[model samples]
Target: MTATSSPLFRPLQLGPLNLPSRIVMAPMTRARSSQPGDVPNALMAQYYAQRASAGLIVTEASQVSRQGQGYSFTPGIYSDAQVEGWRRVTEAVHAEGGRIVLQLWHVGRMSHASFHADGLPVAPSAIAPQAQVWVAGDDGVGRMVDSPVPRALSVPDIAAVVGDFRRAAANAMRAGFDGVEIHGANGYLIDQFLRTTSNQRTDAYTGATLEGRTRFALEVAAAVASEAGAERTGMRLAPFITQRGMDCPEIIPTILHLARQLDATGLAYLHLVEADWADAPQIPESFRAALRQAYQGRLIVAGGYDATRASQVLSDGFADLVAFGRPFIANPDLPRRLAHGLPLAAFDPKALFGGAAQGYSDYAPYEAVAEATA
Candidate 1:
């Protein structure tokens, strides 16, 4: 079949943006942001502009505040410099006729003490994710370190973080992004609050009841949607991810409940991050159907999808878009390559994180590689 005829090439109207294709560039942390302030830079802008063929580009998760940060070089949206830095990114993508959104993030317990002033991460409960985050030393060498137990957030603290999300959304608009995506997945702060394994709070946002567990996520979503306009806001969720101490049996139902609430609030899209590791538990097709029924808005699914699986998911009538993470790293023109059934270039594992433009932006398009080979 021709690339144009494939389901992956289908055009989609998500919120106020009209995407040219269903192929989305998923958010991935490359840890290359400018240091000292964790600001987005011209290099980051160039990196994104290289992949402008995507129907949608969700920028790497940018922390909403210093307290939300979990990694060394990841960018933030709270400061004026960070906003201006992101402006360059938005302008570059827009100049290339691409639509982009900033993923508003708060790592919660998925963080290290080095990223915080108090030398402790904060979460819904005082639990450790038992996971490791990439932390870079003064020499700029990054190594994975074990996560320390975090302090439980007070009710007032939860409200403060919600305001951070709200401010991040507004800053995304000022930066000229088409929208903002709440990073509610991958055992992050919002995900921590939704899971039984992480959240042991006794407050209103406790994990004891479905409503209590879901309140923090819902409130953050509401605040972001209110600031960015419900039509221009999307959120990501990962009910199948069990890593980072997020193995909650009740997560499936919890996410379903949240999906219904998100749908009711008129958010633009819901991105699902399925577990991508080999031997990881497969997300049941039954749950996919349930999510489709629960959320009426556009759906985007990421994790280990090639062209065929992506097309199949779209044809199955559940997902409106498919997000590619690692594939886009080496193939800037990934949509064209997928459409034409071209070979994909493998990315360098060594330079995957905490690097300059070598693995980040030095990748050539398939045509360029072909011409060079000739």
Candidate 2:
């Protein structure tokens, strides 16, 4: 079958945004932001613009505040400079006729003392994930370091974090983003609160019940939606991955509950990040059916999806869009390559983060590669 006939090539409506195709560029942490302030730069803008052929582009996770930062050189959305820096990125993608959204993030327990002023990361509870975060040395080289136990957030502190999300959503709009995506996946702050094993709080925020465990995530969704307009708001969730010691069975039910609530909020879409690794567990069909029944919004699934699998899911009516992660990273013209069955370029693991244009914007388009070979 030709690319034109594939379901993945069909156009879809995400709230007010009209996507040209079902292929989305998933949000990834490149850690290539300008140093000293964790601000977005022209090089990052160029990188995103080069991949503008995607139907939708979710920007790399940006810290909601300095306190929310975990890795080195990851851009932030809280500061004035950060907002202005992101403006360049949005403008670049917009000029290329691509829609872009800013992903608001707060890394809870997955952080180190160097990234914090109080020398302590914060979470729903004072538990350590034994996770590692990338921190930069004085020489500007990045390295993975062990995460420390985080301080449990107090009632007031929880409210403050919600406020930070609201402010960050507003900042994204000021920075020229078409919308905002709440980063609730990948064992981040919201994910920590959602999983029962990580949140042992007795307060209303983590009130112990399934509803209580999900309160923080729902509150964040509501706050971000209110700030960005529900139609322009989207969120990402990972229900399968057991990272950061968060392998609780109750998480699936918690996600289903959030799904129902999010559907009612009239949000643009819900992004699900599947466990793509070879050894990772596959998402059950029962759970997928349950999610489809619970949520009525646009659904996007990502995780090692090649052309055939993407088409199968879309044709089966299981998902409205398909997001490609590493494929999009290595091939800037990923949509074209997938459509035409062109050979893909491999990504350099070493140049994945905190680097210049060597492995980033320098990835040649298929035509360039063809020309060089010819």
On lDDT, the candidate that comes out on top is 1
* After superposition, candidate 1 runs with Cα above 4 Å error: none
lDDT of 1 by residue, 1-374 (tens): 67877889978899889998999999999888887799999999999999999999999999999999998899999999999999999999999999999999999988998987889999998999999999998888999998899999988888999999999999999999999999999999999999999988887887999999999989999999888999999999999998888899999999999999999999999999999999988878899999999999999999999999999889988799999999999999999999999999999999888888998999999989999999
In model 2, which regions exceed 4 Å deviation? none
How do the predictions measure up, each by TM-score?
Answer: 0.99, 0.99
Model 1 residue 39 distance off true place after TM-score fit, in angstroms: 0.8
* Residue 263 C-alpha lDDT in model 2: 91
Cα lDDT for residue 170, candidate 1: 95
lDDT of 2: 0.91
RMSD of each: 0.8, 0.9
What TM-score, to 2 decimals, does candidate 2 have? 0.99
